[model samples]
Target: MRLKDPMKRLNAGLLIIAFVLSLFAGRLVQLQGIDSGKYEALAMDQRLRRIELPAVRGTITDASGRPLALTQEARGVFADPSLIDPAKRTEVAARLSSMLGLDVQKVLEAISTPDSRYVVLAHSVTPEKGRLVLSLGYRGIGVVPESRRSYPSDAVAANVVGFVNQAGDGGAGLEYAQNKLLKGVPGWQRVEISAGDGQHIPMGEGQTQEPVPGQGLRLHLDQDIQWEAQTALADAVKEFKAESGTVVVMTPDGRVLAMASVPTFDPNEYAKADSSELQNRVVQEAFEPGSTGKVITAGALLEEGLVTPESTFDVPDHLWKYDKKFKDSHEHETYKNITFGGILAKSSNVGTIMASENLPDDKLYNYLTAFGFGAETGVGLPGETRGLLHPPSTWSGTDRYPISFGQTVSVNSLQMASVYATIANGGVRVTPTLVAGTLDEDGAFTAAPAPASRRVISEATSHQLIRMLEGAVGREGTAPAAQIPGYRVAGKTGTAERYVEKAGGYKGYTASFAGMAPADDPQLVVQVVLQDPKKKYYGGDTAAPVFQKVMSFALKSRKVPPTGTVAPTLKMFAD
Candidate 1:
């Protein structure tokens, strides 16, 4: 009986041991099979860190590869509010504020929130500033390398290159128009790091996908010419005490060499610039072209064979149209017989209107439309305005006559400039383009799509109009100031009274000069417009002088050969 009891106790002990082992095995299965993914995810959350890799914006360059807008490498300063010491918070805030130009109170508020693990202190912290902050050994504050958008030349091409916002995206000008191509794809970095310090863990796994850099832009603008145009426009505006001004320089090929607007601002400190200064007035502001519209009328009539250059018209001092009577800029003796070219040289409103009498309103309107009036130039700049061009049905019987002289018709600076450029280009209208092409990081170039082009008038007629325009620049003509010393120049001067909403009539005057140089075989076309001049408001006195300077500089700079000889003599008036 003693032996049996011992054996039974042994068996019971073994059975207890087996049951305990089975329970442990079942627990192991639950942990290793059903809940394995859940614990693994929890460990990954604590161990791995994800850092966003920012993409850079493209560089904007002048035609000569001069940097206008660039993405400069910089460092961004940030703070971990959860890690910041409460007692030393004030001192830390002051240090950051002084070094980074941040507001002290704003930094204090950001550092005081314990729930925030990340708070941005300065967006574009310079490397020097970042080093200074890090040298102070603030435990919670950190610095990371980033890109700071910079304009190297302050206010040089303000309206063209524009300025970027806090997010580093282009907000205006060419930057805004080509935003998609300029901004590159962003990427990410996955790294295993300690949660407490954000330091890479020893023997940790990491993977990084580098961000692709953006393509670079190459513009059609010559930096030197742009500087000249901007300087000239600014000087003219200040000298005349005008409200605003604009100048556009182009070539026969329709390349916009420079487009400048006054009331300008430095794009570098765009935040301080007013909204009005940011607008590119060359393409946005519209005005009645006044007598400048005569070029289109002359060309239209000449192209249709309705009038020859030597055709005669009896020009009276004043013509009554409906209740309104039209008069010249100043009273002049009536010409009993005036050739078409002579009328243009004198800018006779009566002469131009009488010439337009033969052409139907529909034909005149079509010619105006063909000249690119009342439409966008598709220059690809943002905020481009299409000036108003009403249909023929909207015009009264007398409206056509006034429209012939550039009243009751509106056009922007570029449109007006393009009119002369068309004539200079032998009547083929080429779309004006600012962008030359895009350059990739590999130093490869992608040319911008060629601008659309179409013929507006016969080349033979263009030659005849060019001859008349040359007469308009003669000493006896309106724009004697537009004469260049060596080059044979051709252009027109226009002074149009600006309309007032309250008066429903003209108030201020917009003086404008549009012309091309080396008239025999033109290479460049320069346009200048001055608005609300406090001094002299005539196009010949105010705007024509500006054109002279710009065209002179461009002609000399381009090294264009001079015609040397005087223009062909046009009969001032037919006897």
Candidate 2:
């Protein structure tokens, strides 16, 4: 009876265990056969969740590879309002406000919002401050790395390089012109985030995707030359008390060495500058070029074989006719019979008119057009204005004579420089260019396509013009200050009365100097325009000196060896 009772108990326990095992097996089969794929997919989704991380914008460099505009890492400081401890909130906010130069009340308000899960404490914090804030290990504070554009060169080529916006949009200069190249594709970072609060998942493996930085851009500008040109021009503007000024230096082959306009602004701080200061006046504004136009007229005459360097014009000190009467800049005691060289040397308006009177209007128009006038220079600079050159049909009565001497025609300073550059480069008219190359994300430079060029005139004509320009920079010429001690200097002086919008007449004068140095074998061609110098109104006195100083630096910086000695003093080569 006892043995039977024990067997019955053992059987009862085995039955209970068998029933439980059967229940567990049935549940496992249902989950594995029916819901297993869905649960696995959910786990994978959590593991593979991805978010886009914005890429950093590219750097802009000079031809020599000096950074003009660049980007660096910055930290974004944020706070979770709910997690901020009530007792420690005030202390935390106070410390953050002091460190960040923010108001404590602002910080408190940012953290006080009950509905807001996160608030920006600071948009961009220094690395030192970011590290300090992170070390606090507070429950609410968080730091995220962000990209910020920096101008390490600090406005050396601000107008040319431009700057970027908050959302990484290029604003002006190369930044605006080559935005597609500078802005790279944003990559992705797969971060394991908490399901409850979207915090960094602390206990699990996180994923990261390397950010793709933007492509770098190379400009045609030379940094040393740019610095020299900018400094000298700014100094000249300040010294002359002029309203504004521009300096452009270019190689004979049409490479823009430097272009600077003042009063200038820093690209890094462009937001604070006035709108007017941001405009690149050299390309955007067109003023009547005054006597600089004489170079075009002189070149046209020489190119057509109508006038030679020795060709003489019976020019008076003064010529009076229509509503406007013209005269040479300076009065001489003698009624001098001057040569073509003398006409250009003195920038004589009357002499230029006499030389151009016999030429047909069609030839004149064609000549100006060939020299890259009345049309865009194709420099690709933003806001470039095609200077105002009235065709034969557009010219009014008496416009021809005035236009011949660089009056009644408007042009940009850059256009004037291009004309000189073309003449310097042996009549080969190459398009002026600023960008040297564009780079990819991996720092490989895709060279900028070669600029288009055309032969505007014969080499013989360019040579003849150079000889004539040599006389112009001689002691007897108007631009004596343009003389370089060791090399041939050939250039022109321009003094034009500015057109007054209010009075409907010409008022103040714009003084300018355009020239090419080492005339025997041309290298650098520089053009400077000073608008409304208060004390000095003549180009020779005000603008030519600046050209000398700038070109001197430009020649040495380019390492252009000095040629045969400059003629004892700059004097007309009476050959």
- Who wins the lDDT comparison? 1
Model 2, span 1-575: residue lDDT tens: 35568889899889999999999998888778788888866775654445456677888888888888887888777776766788888998898898888899999888787866557777546778889887877777777677778998786878777888766778887788778767777777665544444355656565677776778888889998888888998999899989889999999888998999888798777888887778788888788888888888888888788888777767777887677788877776433556887888878888898888778888888988888887877877778889788889977778888888888888888889999999999999999988888777677888988999999888898887777788778877888899888889999899999986768987789999999989989999999999988889899999999999999999999898878764433233333
By summed lDDT, the worst window of 10 consecutive residues in model 1 runs over 193-202
Q: Which 10 consecutive positions of candidate 2 have the poorest summed lDDT?
A: 566-575
Tell me, by TM-score, which candidate is best. 1
Task: Please report the TM-score between candidate 1 and the true structure.
Answer: 0.91
Q: Estimate each model's TM-score.
A: 0.91, 0.84
Total clashing pairs for each candidate: 0, 3
Please list the Cα RMSD from the true structure of every candidate, rounded to 1 decimal place: 4.1, 5.5
For all candidates in order, the CA lDDT equals 0.86, 0.82
